[model samples]
Target chain A: MEKFKKNERVVALIKILSDNPNQVITLNRFSELLNAAKSTISEDISAARKIIECLALGEIETIPGALGGVKYKPILTLEQSLEFLKRLCTELKDPSRIIPGSFIYMSDVLGNADQVATIGRIFASCFKEKNADYIVTIETKGITPAIMTARAMNIPLVIARTGNRVTEGTTISVNYVSGSKKIQTMSVSKRSIKEGSKVILIDDFMKAGSTIKGLKDLMSEFKAEVVGTGVIMSTAEPDHKVIDDYVSLLILNDVDETSKTISIIPGIK
Target chain B: MEKFKKNERVVALIKILSDNPNQVITLNRFSELLNAAKSTISEDISAARKIIECLALGEIETIPGALGGVKYKPILTLEQSLEFLKRLCTELKDPSRIIPGSFIYMSDVLGNADQVATIGRIFASCFKEKNADYIVTIETKGITPAIMTARAMNIPLVIARTGNRVTEGTTISVNYVSGSKKIQTMSVSKRSIKEGSKVILIDDFMKAGSTIKGLKDLMSEFKAEVVGTGVIMSTAEPDHKVIDDYVSLLILNDVDETSKTISIIPGIK
Candidate 1:
């Protein structure tokens, strides 16, 4: 019998396992395939586990029953995704977040990596079931997470600009009121969206839900349906309108600069 | 000799290896520590690798050299970061992006998970070197990436809200021009930024750099030093009064809504 080399044995085992996702491949059968001793097979199995773990491509599980074997899981949990966003909100909510009128400063958290991962995951999970054809958001801050989410789902994203421009093609503009009682028009070009598409509305924050409302109105011209909405953080204040079935990772209750105190609550749905 | 349980042995290996990030660990040393046969130690190492990869913590390396040993590189590469962002940006450059004259809709991307990951890695790589004391951005879209970036760097993020609210704290406002004609007053609370601190500016776009300049002026009152600036996307048409060290993941070139052709260039910064 040819003695099995460790590398060769491990590679052979993975090939066999690839044929069976979420199924346990028995150790005994694996040993026979590699024609190696039980201990040698065990070593090879362990090596294979390491390789898979490092890649994050899949998972390995060991079954304890009589016919048990190793299986793999390739999904991320909802809590794990939200935890990343919460961490970002927590760190960003430091005393320095204290700005006049109880408003906190938070641009830094949006630009960081770990936090971005959290935001992307949370939004992805919300839209995963929708099979959204496209992702849409207002320009500027909304672009980061929108782009991140679109890439993850392998969908295209459309950005709505605030003003009209000649270079953008045809135009459609809608008027909306701001929190400051100012009315402004937000626009999306004619050629930007396809007719009869499903869209997921995304924003950094939802104060009055006016901007999202404007976006929804803009989507109407394209005959697009807004499947869902997502936000990283939101104020729990009652005066604001809420987008149905929307998700936010953090809820800001109060932010004070002089006293340097911020009240934050974990967000759900 | 009594043998260590496979799970315990695997966990121990992971602990040791993780503690020595980006460094090589010899197989002999591993065997000695686990007090197991060389074959057993090898098996344990492989098992541990599988778990790490699945968790998305990092990676493992095997060097085929006389002096080479198994090494785990905990760091993720820049190319991987950029690739993720590029994929994200491509999907986001949809014709649906054009709003009114030429604005692109992107709130969805900003709120999604994959986009968050791309934004996180980009900023993490950019500020991976800078010991950023704080992350700063104005309200709205800028907040998403700012929070994510700060979380990746494990730093605090501060946000400056628009308008004056007395309940928050004392604040200062700066006048900046937007749309080249209108004078807009953007405010930052006095206590938001610390004195003589290093801050990285984060924003969603840089059409005119006035928003950034307004933030810079606000930071001046606190005597905060502006370290750098970063954006998820930029037009690159030189709309800004002055441009400094900045980064963008995508560039919107032309949005022909009528023709349904929106031109884009992947971010160079």
Candidate 2:
């Protein structure tokens, strides 16, 4: 095998680390793949790490021990985060997005790949310290962001379905009242979650926080715990929420039907 | 502004291109970001591109024109694809995965981040030439693979819900027979897909191809054309399928309930 140059090695290392975020890659693997010595691989990693940190692209943590190596964790600077959110607020201000019942239409934004990935990285960074075993979300809109977060954190994604399906085999179901004050049933495959696991809950939008609370209740059925909760947007109404501890990226303040005006602000961290 | 070293520039270039696959990045933009001359930036991109191709990580296409600079596209070698499918077949061989009615319980595999991403890349490569405007899939199991493909293709994902929700605004619903020979209603938001657009349908599993057909029927309602369809697995029992043209990675041939045995193989391209 031919040895790779410093530039080529750096490029490959960045791609490998970025693709498998939060997962350790030993120096031996790099040395073997690039056909280089351990010392050369170490220098290459250091150079890549400095570039990542210097640009505030993300972080590379070096673990010290026999079972340790290096792992990448994606991060965005405060300025970058605020800039992205502000742009999101502006895009969401379109009155055409106002649907009936004061609901904002954000399917386009939530479905866009670039936007969803950026949001996922931001949410994953926030919950990285929680040591979550899984990232959980309800079916439909929340799956995209939840999947991205799961990829970023190198964890499994457990989706709570609205009902059971034949493909899911036996399932455990839970009932909770939705924001509309209607009782809804949410179910998950019996084998999806293991007992005593810590999970982070993510969703596209939050209103009365009923769905999130329902997830918490559902997690209890498996003896699992909800370590953290994150949402892209939450409404300002309902004064009091079903759950108090959660993080939201945007807050929907008011939507004026008469003038076709919408108001949005960044959510409190 | 400080100039970036070639090693740092190469790392950043790979990260940016990998993050935004299938999107073009102009030389001027890189020069501005790195605070270097266009010639220097061009050299960095060439180095990065060579490294990517040498490692079979992906491809960087440099279009020569006023509008084009470079675009990244992810690809997997045939050997890599076959190896991945072989491993997947082994994982699915466990008799415990066989549920009642000979259906396989694959929620665990579908929800897994790493496996889903690999499947997504394979599917995306298969359908990349279609230039799909949106990736469409039904709710629940298919969302993960669809989202990954959407991310890879740099497009939006439009999910068809099992039922309508207030959050989705007005929806167009269609009824079709599922593999269980039961009539099911699937709906998508009215604004999710634009008229005259091309879409690709993706799903986790197929039996009788009823769900894919349903998605096709649903897409026609919006005047959107279904250019391609892909799935992770399909059963071989259904010799005659609802959709004749589609790609599946794995084929489940037989499952003996009495002896607790299962048979699986790679699907024909």
Candidate 3:
């Protein structure tokens, strides 16, 4: 390999660190890869750290002592997060997004890479200190944000399915009444999670919080604990939610079908 | 904002480019954000480009003429890709992964963040030239890889569900035969995809190519063209396949029930 200058080394370092957010990269490894001394690597990291902080991209924390190194944690300021949610509210207010049953068409928003990345960063920032062993979510629409959050948090994603599949091995199933008062069964492969694991649940939308309650029940089967719950949007219709302690990015306050108007506000933590 | 040095600029530039891979970013935008002259921005980009090329991270191409700028395209050399697939094959060979009905339990692999990112990069590199308007996949298991690919390709992800949901306005449904000769129906929201668009189908696994066929059939209903297809794994049992043209990263050659041994190899493009 060719020798690299400090500028080149910094670029490569940023690439690697950003790609594996929340994971520590020891100084020894950087020194070995860049063919530089620990002091040189330290200087490079300091410069990179300063840039990241100045740009408000994220934060780089240094852990001292053996088995210690530096790690990057993505952050979204309150103002930035509020601005994003406001934009999301504007997008959701589109009358065409209104569907039967007063559901907003957010498939496009959920499927967008940029929007998903931003939302994931916000959720990951909120749950960064949970010491979560895994990021859990129900299958389908929630998978995108869950995957993004898992990536940001440097954890594995465990998806619970609506039903059992033959390929999933032995599965644990739990039945919970959905918001619509329908009894729905949710399943997770027994091998997916371990006992005594800490998990954070994420989802695209929460109506009556029935799905989240179902997930909590399913997690209990594996002896796992749901430390936190985050949702992209939650409706206001369900005055009584099954799960009270949770965080939502946006709150769907009201949707007037007759006038084709929808009201939304930033969620309160 | 304070003035940033070359090292800081390069780090920020790399972060922005890597986050939005395959998207052209104008020099003017960088200059404005960095509060630097176009010439200085160009110099910084040149240094960044050199570092990226030297490390074999990816390519930074500069487009000439009006409406032109720099675009980052992630690349994985054949050696790197083969190494990754080989490791994946080794992981899949675990005897305990063999489940009932001769299926392999790979939910863990699909749920893994690092592995999913690598697989997504390989798929994105393969289909980078397809000019796909959307990366499409079925709901559930395939969503992780599909979302990763969409992020890498800088495109929107479109997930087709097993059935229609009231939340998804009008949906188009298509029925296709499964590998076991059973009938299955798949549907996509009418608003999710536009007419006369190009799409690529992705999945976690393929058995007799039934699901890909279903996706292709579903795409036809919307007047969308299936530009390409990619899968993480495909079975060797099916002497004949439903889809003739598709790419698989790994091929499951055999899985012995009695001995609890499995055989796998990298699939040919």
DockQ for the candidate 2 complex?
Answer: 0.80
Stretches off by above 4 angstroms in model 1 are: A1-116, A138-170, A177-182, A204-211, A231-269, B1-127, B135-170, B176-184, B189-191, B202-215, B229-269
Candidate 3 lDDT, B128-150, residue by residue in tens: 88999999999888888888888
Candidate 3 wrongly placed segments (more than 4 Å): none
lDDT for each residue of candidate 1 in A1-269, tens digit (9 for 90 to 100) = 55544554554466445323335678788767667777777777677677555533345677877897775443245665556556665786678666555656554445444345446556766667796888888865566666556644556667777676453556788887755667888787565577999999877777767777888888887899988888777788855574566777678787666668788877863
Top model by lDDT, which number?
3
* TM-score between predicted and true chain B, model 3: 0.96
Ten contiguous residues with the weakest lDDT in model 2 chain B: B73-82
What Cα-based lDDT does every candidate model obtain?
Answer: 0.66, 0.88, 0.89
Ranking by lDDT: 3, 2, 1
Model 1, position B101, has a per-residue lDDT of: 58
List chain A TM-scores, every candidate, in order.
0.71, 0.97, 0.97
- TM-score of candidate 1 chain A against the true chain A: 0.71
Q: What's the true lDDT of residue B49 in model 1?
A: 67
- Candidate ranking (DockQ, best to worst): 3, 2, 1
Model 1 chain B worst lDDT window (10 residues) = B14-23
lDDT of model 3, residue B215: 95
lDDT of 1 by residue, B102-204 (tens): 6776655554543554475567667666766888887666666676566555566677666665433566777767545577777765655668999988887
